[model samples]
Structure formats: structure tokens, C-alpha cells
Target: MSAAHVPVLLAEVVDALQPRAGETIVDGTFGAGGYSRALLAAGSSIIAFDRDPGAAQFAQGLPADRFRLLERRFSELDAVTGPGAVDGVVLDIGVSSMQLDQAERGFSFMRDGPLDMRMAADGPTAADLVNAAEPAEIARILYVYGEERESRRIARAIARRREEQPFTRTLELAEFIEKTLGGRRGAKVHPATRSFQAIRIAVNEELAELEAGLVAAESALKVGGRLCVVTFHSLEDRIVKTFLAVRAGKTPGGSRHAPPVETTAAPSFQLSFNGARTASAAELAANPRARSAKLRAAVRADAPVWRAAA
Candidate 1:
């Protein structure tokens, strides 16, 4: 793992969790075991999960009794570790710096390598999605996940290029996007950045996993237990924000003219703070990835879990 791959929101996450001796906390991301290490230092038992097998290799030599690592995604958390049993659950959602730093992982357009961007290293790669997805479907992924404005144009370019020669390498895809979108001249951000983000998210099913994981986390947490999520992009942050708001019953009030309805399901969570928190300027200076991170936390309310609307 690269030394530069420091976990974002480390201090804030640890402080929010407030782990205590004998308490069991779940580090749902387990990227580089940064948060897990801190929790262990605080004398809390940790159950850490990472879908990436590479991360498990790095976790060797860690105290086995105090910390246990699971080779699973956070969405499968409830299935593996029974529901409503944890004291707290922390998820650092989206791609990890470890995956992005290694060019072989093919997450970064800045470095040239194979166009593979599988977090697990054994799943469908970015190349597969880009080469096979329909133009409309590709456009939708870019728009929704990457928030790319020129999604249609970019998708069209990708479709056109792949017909002549399918992209197999990172720079091949990146250079195609750059040339088609107009390379570096006065570009605030790289032209290929959003396109790469869209493909990676699609390849990993990141948004879907996040949604499922949020629901699973809510169900898995005990009443009064906390769920803390750190999101680095707007799409993920928006989902986290809305999920917490809905659970806290913070929805806009109904008009007085409307008939009052009896409550069938109790609100399951209360916001730990008024709004999301960001890292300190000092932290951002040390880790640039921390700049975009937003932390949202909520404590489970003393109520039964509410099923999704049918």
C-alpha cells in the first residue's frame, strides 16, 4: 500500500464512533485498516470487512482476538453478522485510495495500465462495461454516477471508438476521452475524469451497493447504536443524506388540511448532529482526498425497523 493512501476523515470518524472497552464496532470498509487500527487502539473489539482480497493480505499479523476481518462487502453485513447486534458501524463509502494508487488496479486515468477497475480483482472490469454497454445505458451511468454533463456525447464517442478497436488499456480509454472532449486546454479538471468515474462506479455497482448497505446498516444496528458514513462524492453523499433524513423523520411537514395518519412504523434514527461535517483544513492539506469528504452520522432510535415501501 502506498504511504500517501491515508484514510480520509480519520480523526472525525474515530471521535464520532466514541469506541469504548468491551464494545464491538464494525469497520465496514476496512481499507488499509486505518479506522480499525484506531478502534483497536481504543480497546474496542472490531469486526472489519473488505471485499478486496488484497486488503486481507495487508491485514496479516494484526491481533486476531481483538480484530477479525471478513472478506465481504458491507451490503452482505447483516447476513454474515446477525442484525441489530453491533454497538456502532462505520462505512467509508466508494473507491479506496489503495485501489486508485496502484495503476495496475486501473482506477486512475493519471497512470497507464489495463482498464480493469475491479475492487475485488475478480469481477467484471471497466473495460467490459465500456465495450459492451449500450450508448444510452453508458450515458445514464455517466450522468448519474459521474454527474457528467456531456454524457451523451462521451458515450457516443466511446461507442464509436470501441467498434473500430475495443479499449484494453487505461491510457487508451483516457486518451480517447481526452481528445474527444477537448484535452487539457483551460480544463479545470481532466476531461477523462468523469468518464472514468462513471465506468468504475458501474463496474463496481457502487451506488447500488451503497443503497443496499445503508439499509443493511440500519437493520443491523441496535437501537441507540450509531451509523457513520463518509462519502467523497455528491452522488454517494446525497444518498446518505436522504437516507438519514428519512430515517430521522426529518421530512417536510404535511399541511394542516391533510388528515393525520397513525404511525405504523417508528422513526429508526436520529441525526447525531444538525448537518454533515467536513475535515479540518489541516487534514485536507495532509490528504487532498479529504477535501471532498462529507461525514454524516445518526443514532438508531428506540423503535422497530421500518421496511421499505412496497
Candidate 2:
């Protein structure tokens, strides 16, 4: 198995996949290849995907034939595998430990590093957004992605500060944000948490990627194949929850806020397990990061893939 960081909910994710020998499985986020390694050990062949070019180093030593790592984003899974060709698909959403632990990656506010949060090596960095985006747009991103109620206040501070000196390093922005919030109080979380999350999400466009990847996974899995997703934050969990709920034809009937819901097609998937599952206390103790992790799994129905709703 490759040396990707230890996967969160390893046993539970594998159990949901129920991979067997000779089956081909998709590990949509191959950060450190923990899930791919577990799937490999389960007697399944794996086609792993990761957008970060740096992640390719972890693919070394994995079996050449049984394991293949694509430097492509998980959103491209359908293009790689073709329709209904794989046995199962699994996605571990959001940033990985390898990225977070590296100060150079700028994924965490706890440590200082470059303000480059691009999961892939290229494109606009977090520095680019904070240094260039309009204050209102920045405020909107923080409000929508990070759920920060004080987004405008924070954005105004950022806009003012960047005028004197543009943010170039991760800690520079983090400390500035904390100070703008009047310093940390008794709260266990850092004051910069929400802004960092918001900036990172904008830099990477992660939410859109997640939505596209979910649709791609649906297109790639075979009949009776499984789809498993693990998400850390509420935004990601909401997407997974709603996608599964909608695909399973379990969306609640319409209310006054909306028109009557339409069920124009057969269900695309059946729940492999009941609702979302959380980590056990034992697992949480072993890895504090597992505290917020949520797992959702489903099996593909024989019905044809439905067009993405508008």
C-alpha cells in the first residue's frame, strides 16, 4: 500500500464499499492513498484520482497493475472510467492531512506559510483573491462558504490592510484576521478559522468540484455498484445528503416556500445504509480529525442516469 496519510473512517468506508476480488474501485480523492490502500488490501483493483500533482509521490511502491493514480481531479472520473464500468466509487471530500500539515500548502491558520492554497500547483492562490477581489465579493464568499456572520466587517478590514501591504504569506493574513476580530477570547477555535476556510474554498472552487464529482461518480458506477462519500464540514455534508436524498427519490414533498416537487424519473440509487454515519468514540479518540467526519453510501439502481437538474 502507498504511504498516503491514514484515511479517516477507514474500516467504515471499506465496509460500505464491500469490495471483492477482481472488482475495480474508484478512490476519487487519493490524498496519501489511505482509502486506495485499504481497497487494495480488500482484494479490489483501484483507479485512484487526485488533483494535486504533489500527491503522485505517494503512488510509488503501490502495485503497478492493480493500482493506478491519476493526477486528474476526481471530477474527471466518468471520462476516465466510462459509464457503468467500475464496481464502486469513494470520495473523501475536502483537504487532506498531507496538505494541512505542510505549512507551505497554506491550508491551516495554525501555522504560517505561503498564502497559496491551490490544491493543484497552478492557478490563482489565496493571496490572489484577497489581494485582488472586491471587498463585497470577498464578504460574500466568507458568508456563503464559511458561514461567517461578520463577513463584511472582516472583508473591510482585509481590504484596508491589503492597501498598505498585500498579503503574501499565510500567517500574515491569519494574524491580521485574528487582530481584526479583537483577538481570540476563551474560544477554542482561532478567530481566523472562518476567513481562512472561506478564502481556501474560493481559491480552489471546491464546492463546484464536489458537485461535479458527485454527478461524475453517478455516471461511472455500474448497476449494483456502490458510492461512498466522506465530508468534514456542513456545506459538503449538505451536498452529499441532498444529492443522495434526491437521487433516492426521498426528497420531502413541496412546502409553501417552493412549487410542488417533481419525480420525473426512476430512482438512480438505493441507500446502502440508513442516513449519515458518524465515527465512534474509539475512532474519534484515535484521530481527533474524525470528530466532524460524516459518511454516506448508496448502491446504484438499474435505472438510467438522469440529466442534472437546472
Best by lDDT: 2
Estimate, for each residue in 203-264, the C-alpha lDDT of model 2 and write its tens digit: 88899999999999999999999999999998898888878887898875644433345677
Error of 1 at 126 (Å): 0.7
The global C-alpha lDDT for each of the candidates, from Candidate 1 onward, is 0.85, 0.89
Residue 78's lDDT within candidate 2 is 96
C-alpha positional error of residue 105 in candidate 2 after TM-score superposition, expressed in Å: 0.9
For candidate 1, lDDT tens digit of each residue in 1-310? 3547557887888888888888888899998988888888899988898989888876877789988998888898877668788888999988888788789999999999999999885888899999999999999999877889999999999999899999999998899888988888997889989889889888989988998998888878888888899998888887788778777887534333222233546689999997899989899788778889999999988877776431
Supply the global lDDT for candidate 1: 0.85
